[model samples]
Target: MPDDLREGRIVIVGASLAGLRAAETLREEGFTGSLTVIGDEPHPPYDRPPLSKQVLLGRMAADSAALPMRRDPDAEWRLGVRATGLDPVGKQVLLADGESVTYDRLLIATGTRARPWPNADEAALDGVFTLRTRDDAGRLTKRLAAGPRRVLVIGGGFTGSEIASACRERGIEVTLAERGPGPLVGALGGTLSMLAAGLQRAHGVDLRCGVTVTALRGNGRFTGADLSDGSRIDADVCVVAMGAVRNTEWLAEAGLAAGPRGVACDAGCRAFNMYGIVTDDVFVAGDAARFPHPLFEYQMLSLEHWGNAVTQAEVAAHNMVSPEPARRPHLAVPVFWSSQFGLNIKSVGVPTFSDQVVIAQGSLDERRLVAVYGYRGRITAAVTVDMAKWLEYYQGLIETAAPFPPGPGAADGRPLVAAFPVPSNVPDPKGLFHGPTVALTGHLPDRRLTVVRPAD
Candidate 1:
């Protein structure tokens, strides 16, 4: 077996944001190794957040969303090539072009893809699009700029909401259909998400709550959408802003503990086998990894957030080159942001992990406040809208396992509630936009841990 990964070839899958950052981190850690980064997309590593925002709003071109290199790793880049299989025994990755990449260590950073609309025939319509890749954004942004009669945005999630915001900013009429009671009900719960619903409707969006898109009707181009509420919308353009789907299908036969959530990994980013045994050389990172976080009840979480992609990649890269004793675990708090309809929403922590929410600062009606999420008398997450300054204080509470609703000095000298009950029926995004592919399985994580060394 290879003694260490200081010199031998190291291959990385998913040459997107996380993949490029990991390569840079590998070099920064003083590892002079042969690195090969593979991506299914032709473009080099690019920033995805901007694709949904600036690119879609026509402020920036999608092709120009390439992320500035954090550090010069100078690794071999394999773009536009699909990874077909992984041969763990041979330490080789099978490429779709019938080529094999042998490696001493492997990093899986394949993040996720945009969940497309169901009903393949309907999805293939001209104006129907899903935003995920840079190319997808380029196409959608240009299409949105064409000034369609009415835009139909399916799903009230962040992506869909952002797209609707962009369309409204363009002065185009938009119809947002959500099966849930309110916008962002899946992530921010019913109480806060109701504010989002009001915000969208006030901005001239035909916000239809408690209705799902039944079908898309168009010959070759999108004409309109059929709703589950026995109503039809005349939509010339439709944007499916469903969440994400983890790109882990290529590892089906690798005998790794991978499922719909993602490849199971330890806090140290070490990939586990199908039998729940950890491997020494195979590591997982980015959105494709479902690892345990101490802050979230020690439950294995699969996050597709942008901050987690860079944080976890650096941790995986460092652990890949360092000795076991010198290695570290990735316990970074999950943080994410989305700008939509003139509101800047930021979240620190897993909002879904909480059972209750409270208004910590400002009022929801003012559209400038923070909601603290709690579960079982403990703070689990916090969401702020245009009030990000107070988020840091709440983030500290979450990290130290602070109590729910917070104590005195938690906010700006305001009274704190101890048992703030989050509205119990925060609709599941899967239930709202059932067609989007992003799914975080609601299963008790398999936390069975095992330590192993290379065979003699």
Candidate 2:
């Protein structure tokens, strides 16, 4: 490693999980230069997964979810300040407070924010809320504890489902409205989502599928919501859990390949310029980065999973300090998990990228099973319900690109023939309000380019 690479100024844009981890890695890699981390929120880096689970359940406080740092990076912390824009040409980050910070190497770990309800006026209603940050969780937590008559949850995504579960556990009446066929269908596909829908209803959730909240009714405070199916829900509180939007708007004019989806980057975490050329100094990681992976046929993937963010941030930090020959690619497979309705659901690989699926083990009737997904006769992904112990076994199959309809005894040595394969039944992403945890950004053979061109 060259001394020049180790002693340059480095700036990280987001002070969340990925940004914190990347800063720690840069120090561990022996980069002794000046480091700066900027964040719009006033608080330090914190864990977010618990905001919807433990915090909402009253087991943990929102402020107590702070992420423990492995080792102090001894970097400048610019909290409560927003980065208005990026001057890639000038190698500076423009701040909202009429200031610019310069850096030799830049890391955009801005991540994502909760997608709020579209209508501004209705969203302003007192009881309408969207959970994303610690403040949001704190506010919602107090409301849930007040014991509303009925809580209205719009969208059937993981966050919404978890919120619904929390409401039920508190003995509060709640209604869930999903535009899709069932909850979690957009991510886990039709088979397992059916199981999710059943769980919600059995637990006393007013599960309404194939419906959208047409309008939110309120008079200074949330009164209820009108559904697309011509039905109205009268509740004191309404939570909009549609999905998340990547925080790439600040980089819009930076000449990077950034848009509503996210910033485009190479597998090595190098950011691409507007002209599709990779920039050596600018890099991306966390939910804001969309990078290609050879395991998924070189498709650009934008993952919102915690594991991906941690691993990718480390790779980005390492490559940022190492020579070209020593740099490594971020190829960690996507993984995500959620707990709702007394069930622990875990997934490995991109479940939405497959065409067919089969019950490799257990049975859905028992509410415990491993569903394997395949694309073009090769294993692509797998989801386990209360059977997470065997997740690594299926991950190996996916990594090997094992044949579909995995033979009996593929994972377990016991003689149990796998069930016949069936269509994974992944729905069109356009119809759902919730975004999948792992999103395949289409087939981009030449990831260097912004758009795929026809072969001559």
Pairs of residues at least 3 apart in sequence or in different chains that clash in candidate 2: none
The list of candidate 1 runs beyond 4 A from truth reads: 416-424, 434-456
> What's model 2's lDDT at 398?
79
- Name the lDDT value of residue 232 in candidate 1: 97
What is the TM-score of candidate 2?
0.96
Q: Evaluate all candidate structures by whole-model CA lDDT and list the values in order.
A: 0.84, 0.91
lDDT of 2 at 328: 92
Q: Give the number of the best model, judged by TM-score.
A: 2
